[model samples]
Target: MHRCLKIPEILLTIFQNFPSTTYFLEAKCLVSLACTCRDFHAPALDLLWYTLEDLVPLLRIMPDDLVRGKLDPSFWRQWSFSRPLVPSGFERFDYYAPRVKVLTRLSISIDSLTLQDLLQLSSLAKLTDLRMILPDDDMTLPDVQALDHDGVAVLPALLDLHVVSSKLANCTALIQCLHRCTLESINLTLQNPPSGRSLGELFMVLSQSACRASLQSLMISAHDELSHSDEDIVYSTVLAPLLLLRSLYIVVIDNSNWPGLDGKSLQQMVLAWPRLCYLHLYTFELGTTHHSLVTLEGLLPLAAHCPNLCTINLGLHASFKMTESLPGRGVINRNVKLLDFGHSTIDIDAVPHVAGFLSDVFPCANIISTWDEDEFEEDEEDEEIAMSTAWDEVISLHPVFVIARHQERFAY
Candidate 1:
């Protein structure tokens, strides 16, 4: 009888030592073990709760009927799933209130009311990191604005906040909110056109904040409808205030209308960002006319200003004539360690010219090109396979760097 009891104990010990049992998997097994005997019940319950705390989304998505599931009644008895799990609203606070003390990082999809509830979750006062992803629609603006309003006063411990929205008005509000916090870094998507108030409001907020001095990184995207004049104003007002910015990424979405920046204005802005080290730019369908493609010419002068720039990414749409005028390899800074170029067609013959230009500009940097045939086939399978292969190849080749692609690359 004693040997029989020892056999079960040895089996349980072996299961606990299994290398493949991850935290989540182990927790599930513990639930089963707890149901078998009173001796395993208390310890298993403790392990289950500890593991579930690390997995917050499971709590958010746990179904109401989970309590009635066929698995085990005791497991459900200890677990709390009565509170609502919607991304926003009062129930979110009630559900998280007990567990917030242990949560150091949280990521959630944003809706209009979600931001409001997050603001009221005072338990998150100890949270060090928060990431909110907005839907790709009009709601993005209001959601971001709500966070912007409460972000300053509520999140004193927050070190990073990433907001993706589709309105310039929300971007303006986000900037204003950052002014109130001592944030170390931010990633934002500004997907709307530069309207009158949004543009001025963003600049006004940045100019007033000491947060600009503390910010180390920034990522911004603008709608293609913004005029060259508007872009110039943005660079001068909003970007100029970020005097201490180290890493920068600017993506200009290609609306049917091709928007290009003025060469002289770009030159001034590039020269002003002295602390900038990494720069990425994505431009789509800017016109073939003199006014449209002149922005590409500004690259030469822009490279000259950022002596410390170590990485550069450029995505553009251009005709052969515009490509020919592209300043050859010499304009690239020697300090640049990674160079990415996309959208320009490069045949075997043109590869050397492209490579030569890159070698001239950034001689010490590693050059990786995503060269594709000029003709694209309509086969969906081929496209899917090609994309999967391209992503895998890029990831394998460039581990620590990013590859920028034109907006058209995703358009069907």
Candidate 2:
């Protein structure tokens, strides 16, 4: 009977060792073991509660209605939605308040109602990190403003705040709210078109703020819709403010519409941003030689300014001529680490030119070439044998040279 008793203890030890196992597996095992006897029920319930406590907003939102429905009756009998669900009133808070300490990091992508619910449930005073994605609706501005007013004081421990969107009307107000809070780091993305004041207002806020000193990483993307005249205005406003930033990501869409910065403007922007480490560009409509080439030409001088830049992601309409003209010195000499060219045909003719360009501009960096497989097969191989076994061999034989350097790298 001593050997039989030891078997249960041995199994318990095995379960304890595998703490990193998936929540569903742990929950299922606990439920199964709990059904056997009263002694196993407590351990099983503790494991389930601990697993639920660690779940973030994203995990909570996962499509698990089917799994919840399928759980055995005994598992559902003791399960308490009141514990995990965001508490609202003081009565609900009293029941779940003790569990609020379990939440260390909170990330929410929802509207004001959900945000309010979260704040009401957990005391924001203890939160160390907060990442929120507001809905793409007009009503979000006021709600965000309200949240800033109410929660900013309580979130003294908040070290990081990340906000992503295409458009925001009261961005200046939002920045002001952030300034009130002692944030150590912030990541902001602008994807929506803004009217009235030009894009420069954002940079102006950053440059003028007390928070700028604390900021370690900055990403700015002008919406694709800004007019040529307005685009220049946006960049002009941002240049002076971004000088102190250590990390910067700037994306300009539709190169043809861009008035194309002159060499001096390029020099000023690059020289101003001395500490910049990473640069990314996504240019659309590259075939139009007059405008696209001029825009691309402006980028070469700017690329020379980033002394510490280690990674560059360039997504442009593929062209052998443009690739041949890309700047070579700074990226190659600085030992740039990563280069990504999105969905470009790498033919025998263009491949050599691209290789030469990479060797020149980003010589130390790995050149990652990516193209749609369907398009690659269609363009490079003959129609008759394109669907056959030989087509796979032919395609594999090509030296595509992706940054990751293998097919598995492309796997999501």
Candidate 3:
């Protein structure tokens, strides 16, 4: 054996250098290395169990005599155990749980797991990223008792939590799993707009979270459109708690009614999340009624508050709002690069006005319209094509105006 291979760091580097496109094939090699000798065992095992596709594989690691796996073909490849789970059965489970850093598609059957099962499974002290796609049926974590007397969380070191669910109850239950950890990011996709009560409970949990001050990114998107446009389901007061997350840099909320979010609310958002770099509030295909009360002028507050903001996407009514009347040639946020006006109304004649306004506010921004070539081929509405052309013209004229602004500055 080469002397260099004896160095732990060098060996780990060589092992990581292998192609990861096929993780199962890579795992085959790692299993071989684990069997080769003691030096390769620990590192190979660490890399092997670093990222898990689901908890099923980890549960399978336990002795077959202690826990047997049964596949139920009636439902979605659901796994069940032959015998009741006990604390003594988790010896091997505890061994490999700490090595896992990322866990995805983590769905536990209510019938398969009990309160005791969850307590034994919560030993993943080092888990940093967890993603769950929950079923609408009775999936929850309230039964799992809180941290022990010494004060430790279920996933104590969790940094990112991403969950996609059709029901809000599942999301509420999952949030209860978090105890004392300060999370960095959370992404949620709901198939339907949540009821007022469920939304309130969800926000209440987040507002009281230990990570409220530490959270950096938040995205809440709904897949289904509203049945009726009466009022905004997302009220200002319901979302007010998010303002407490002062360190937030990225916020994206899509396809949800925010009738209450007017120009005043927009200003409050800019002031609350001063470090915002990417802000996307889109309500495409929902019509102008769902658009925020903010006009094109509301963008100035973003320029004044979030100087480092790079990307901006909004559902504001775009028109001439006298943006040229700045104190000193307007506050230009040079960091902004992409400006997306998703299905907001803009007339062809107003292209130059919009372009000029953007050039002054976001001097380096490029206009982005969400429509694509495929939509055009599908014979989309004439209004969509007209708006797309208007945005394209804005894209062209923005850079010219930017150059003219620079020339004016040079002249001064």
Candidate 4:
């Protein structure tokens, strides 16, 4: 143990694995090590502040000498920043802000910080991955004027951004700021959008940005998926510029018919990008009358052209197919692992045929008939009988039919 003590970088690397059920356990353990001795202090703190769970914790550690707000802003029924400030004093936030490379603020309630303190976060030069979940506690928060246009909220080197908030969702200024930075990934979740173009400008910003070449992944959980076509501003403004995108997920989180991309649109999109590996282009409509359904025949282009595809969830059903999997798929079968067939609302016996078809098409694949995680929880026995029977048809030939329930995504 003493011989390996010299390799602090190795020690730091080992402690930074992605946290599972116990996400904060490693951070807490690091804090304990920091208190052990001066030797462990620098390394532990370096790793501890590398990625933060929330900005509130960083705010909490600020020095007492700085001026503090009178009311606890988190629980406020009504609040407004009189003015963005130039604070006369500084504290722990300044010390730790630069070290915070990847920061997550789930339901941001900047209770302790004034506008000045909040604005100071913009100066984080090393900050790359930023995820902010705005708290719905204040209805007036959204109505409040946008943050001062003085580059206070602009993240200079931001590479990845995941923001889930109704207030921040529609801010054109924020989108404008984001356009200036080169981002690799962007995930957004917004609710109660009164109009379809709530995210229109943001899409336009990403599409027209210099970051288009560098961007790889994009996920937008909104009122509706962006529709494609020259007439459809989103496709022209968003998807058109994203030629190199490897992953694309645009689904309406809450069933809303703000109109999404249909089968024709998807096929057109696949032709535009050859690098697509993961796709979840489910129509947001929840009723039987929806016309955006994609027949199994429609996936031929995807299987033939975008050979790198590994995961898909187009809500597919077998009955819609006009044809079968191509005679010999020349494209390399990249061992696709998971699929979401949310539209496989077929008869009991038909499940095997649809599942078996998918297994044949993607040789190494698992089918998820639904994205609703809890739908089959209580009926485990029935699910096994149904799922196993479908897999049995493919397992004898193509051995990769292992299906696992969709794992819940953790916020960080």
Best by TM-score: 3
Each model's TM-score, in the order given?
0.52, 0.51, 0.70, 0.55
Q: Which candidate number has the best lDDT?
A: 3
lDDT of 4 by residue, 45-128 (tens): 888888775565665565444334444322322222334444533356677777777764333333232345445656666577
lDDT of 3: 0.72
Using lDDT as the yardstick, the better of models 1 and 4 is: 4
Q: Residue 245's C-alpha lDDT in candidate 1?
A: 39
Stretch of 10 with least lDDT, candidate 1: 69-78
Cα distance off (Å), candidate 4, residue 135: 6.4
**lDDT of each residue in 19-72, candidate 1, tens digit only:** 544676776787787797766664444444532223444444445543232322
Q: Model 1, which residues run further than 4 Å from truth? A: 1-100, 113-119, 135-152, 189-200, 221-238, 242-272, 290-308, 314-332, 337-358, 365-412
Q: Which lDDT value does model 2 have at 232?
A: 36
Instruction: Select the stronger candidate by TM-score from 3 and 4.
Output: 3
Deviation in Å, model 3, residue 152 alpha carbon: 6.9
The full ranking of all candidates by TM-score, starting with the best, is: 3, 4, 1, 2
Q: Compared with the true structure, what per-residue lDDT tens digits does model 3 show for residues 28-136?
A: 9989988898888888888888888678877787768765555442223545566778877788899889888766435544423345554554676666776666676
Q: All models: lDDT?
A: 0.48, 0.46, 0.72, 0.52
Worst 10 residues of 3 by lDDT: 70-79
